[model samples]
Target chain A: MAKNLVIPIGPQHPSLKEPACFTITLEGEKVVNAVVGTGYNHRGLEKACEARTFIQDLYIIERVCGICSHIHSTTFCQAVEELAGVEITRRAAYIRTIMAELERLHSHLLWLGIAGHEVGFDTLLMYSWRDRELVLDVLAALGGNRVNYGINTIGGVRRDVTPELIEQIRKVADIVEERNKYYIQLALSETTLAARLGGIGKLSHDDAIKFGAVGPVSRAAEVPDDIRVTDPYAAYDEVPVTAITDNHADVFGRTVVRVLEIMESVKMIRFCLDNLPEGDIVTKVPRKIPEGEVLIRTEAPRGEDAHYVRSNGTDKPDRVRVRAASEANWHGMKHMLEGDYLADVPIIIAAIDPCYSCTDRAIILDNHDTGEQSVTDWRSLREYSINWYKVRGIDTSKIKIAYSPLIF
Target chain B: MSELIAEKQALATILEKFPFLEGKLEIQRRQRIISSALERPLFEEVFGFVTTDGGFDNFHLVIGVDDGDNLGFIYVLSNDDKVMLSLKQSAPKSNPAIKSVCSVFPNALWHERELVDLFGAIVEELPEGPTYPLPDGWPAGNYPLRKEWKVEYFDKVNMTYNPPVTAGKEEE
Candidate 1:
């Protein structure tokens, strides 16, 4: 006789840093169904953008996701600039591209480290993370901050890469190239790591295209849908984008695509630096935006980051809508989870490199039939714990525990 | 196939299809621009330009823009050939609902939801489901993106304010 068991993975799991819960129904070791739950951290960014001025929105937008901060701000600013009929200088466009590609490098390395951790490879994780710090250091030197580089504005970037910073980036990229190659070798080598990931969580090209997967996820499935190549924004048009694709859409395939893409980004960064255009980094932007609407899309580290800005001749935008890439990639979760073992769930989710903070907020469910589906908060968990104790008939008055003072 | 030339040809093709689309469509640079009088047919017209023309291949981004008295939306479409189209659609601010484009591109699901959230524009034939972002008990008539909506601390308080209800027993 076989029995069904339900397993809850996350909302607090070690493998995932994001606050998302997935309940997998298992018939023995095989997962039969998986339901995803989110909404742990809801910042309400889109709604908050309404209150901010167009310039202030850039700072708010950068907080959408720390990993892809620059792209988010860039996309938002580009939309606003387009709406206001402001032309960013060519040098600024190049600088934006360089910054975006650098962000990609850091983001990909971060994902690589997490992917390594997911597969139980701590050594690789440590190595990848250590190398990733170099890229962050380079970003800090260029943008004056590691995470949310307040470089992008409406017309152009706020900060320019000085000659010293350019030299620093080149030197760092060289070191990163050497260290990244070693990490790649380790990730690709060792039969155990390859076996666990190579064929797992396979998404076919047809399914990938049908589901509208973007960035490396789709490219890994052999669909060359790169926004950088398709829609060249910033200096991407100047430096050609060589998209990497793999016929196999497994976890390992996604890993290889990201790894190669990082190399491509490194090359593009070097190319941009060597051929850095000579001009002003910023063009003046008007305070009052004309009444118009514009849609802007740029390649965020994970996938395509898009922003829509509408200006009704006001400092604050009338409406701004952001469509993050993770939202589009979430559709494939069901397909990826089907037929996979419970152990593989973390890896499958990590394969997409989802930024839940940007895609969704805390989830609330209500059941109308019983009037029971009220929003479940942490307090409800406490209430359930009290009920559990009551059901067990624990004599709280009889039991006493001694409290110990802090040793320190 | 330069970004500038491709953008120009795309604008020309769009203008040729709807001659009235000429003056309304404004090109900024290689891949950025704005359009006026956005509607369902106008979106279909732009979609036709993308699918039919070998130049424009992918739909990268869709943004819903809400003006005080009118609602406008923009679609950022791109092609492997280097052209980018920023197509705009608009509806009356009083009744800001438009026909759905889920049939043309299934990816419009989230984009439309974002539009609904920010612009309060209803996409006809939107998948019947629970509203995202907005809380269940969020005031029905309140649209946050409207310029008239002020930023008050009370709104944040109400965001977390869910009326309590009695828990149900397994058996009566």
Candidate 2:
């Protein structure tokens, strides 16, 4: 006998941190269908960027996602610079590459920690965060800030990596490398984790390509689609990146691919440090950008983040459209979540390392005939979820709650 | 020569039936930038050809730009040729309706909804998505991304606006 139940999880929920909701229809324990609704934390950045100058928009785009802030600014700056026809120096490119790789390290480690926490392995969460600090320490040493290191300027990088900074980064990379070995061993060899994540939330190779899955998510599914390798941006042409892929497309495959990619990032950072170019970090550009449209795509920590900038010969942009990596990756999540257990939802959602804030800029007005759909505030959504669980005989009072801002 | 040229030639041949598509198609770097002021009737035919025969299999991103009197929708698609195909179409501001390419690219469901919500461009054949980014009870006609749209604060708490007094006013 099949009992069908529609379970709604988040725009605001304790299990997920981001402002995105998953409404999964379950037939007993198995998920019959799932729908994801994001855009709760929409900041209207693309529209806002049109009002601000190219320089001001750098800071605005950096706030897209705190985790992948560097990549956002890097991609935006690249697009604007390309429009202005200003080529930054080799040193600047290498510095940008180093920053980008360091960001990937921090972001993947953060995801690893969250994945651990979701799977009830608090030890991995604790250890990964402890190691993650090393990457942040390196970032702080270079850019003078832990997160959103305003390092990227319009023409080039704002900060220069001195010999001392390089040494510090190298040391941190060594520590990260050591920790990576242990994590890889644990994540791959541990039978408990294998039982939990293996064969769960599987995205087939065809679906990954068809759905436009990016970064490690696609790579984990054995799709060799990496922006760094395919279209070399920044110092990638000079310092090539090896695209790491795993045959397994499930949650475990995603974990393995990300963990291994961290090691690859470590190697790339070392290469940049070893072959640091000697030149000016920035190039002087005129106040007004030349009238043209340009596209800049960079490999963000999560995936291939692209920005389209249209300049109308003014300091202010005519239009700025950002196609976030998570936007492409979310389709993969929707494809994976169906036919899985309701319990596996949290870890699988985190597997893509989705940044809902980065992805959801446009508003969606859902008018489905299901009659199950309704426009509810976070307060109402939270109350509804609590009542929903109570009806299922779960005690809500015992659970400790954490709150994130619902900034739509 | 390259697959890029072959794809371009194939696209030109397929699009030869519509004269508007002429001079609008060109290869920018590795990408085929197809920009044209498409008529409502021609939208599906052109988009379908590109998706099926043109080998622009992957649907990347769909962005709607407000051009004051009209709204421009850019549907970017790509294939193994590693070239992005940008299919640009415009809808009049008064009507604000364009044919949805969601059928051509199934993954474009969210992208089409974005056009509907932000740019107020009506997408035909696509169902409405959630009123996300904008909360429910937001003014019906208020489209934030529209150039003419100005910011207005709704009194959620029903508080009266009190002007901030100058720091030296009390002392003075």
Best candidate according to TM-score: 2
CAPRI tier for the interface of model 2 = acceptable
Q: In each prediction, how many residue pairs overlap at the backbone (N, C-alpha, C within less than 3 A)?
A: 8, 7
Q: How does each model score on TM-score?
A: 0.77, 0.85
Backbone clashes counted, model 1: 8
Error of 1 at A100 (Å): 2.1
Task: Give the worst 10-residue stretch by lDDT in candidate 2 chain A.
Answer: A399-408
Q: Could you give the DockQ of candidate 2?
A: 0.38
* Local distance difference test, each candidate: 0.74, 0.81
TM-score of 2: 0.85
Model 2 lDDT per residue over A82-143, tens place: 88888999999999999999999999999999999999999999889878867776787788
Model 1 lDDT tens row, A115-218:
88888887778777767767776787778777787889889988888898887788778777776676667657868878888877878897786566778888
lDDT per residue as tens, model 1, B63-111: 6655547776666656555455666777887788787766656656666
Over 4 Å off, model 1: A1-12, A37-40, A356-408, B1-62, B67-105, B114-130, B136-141, B160-172
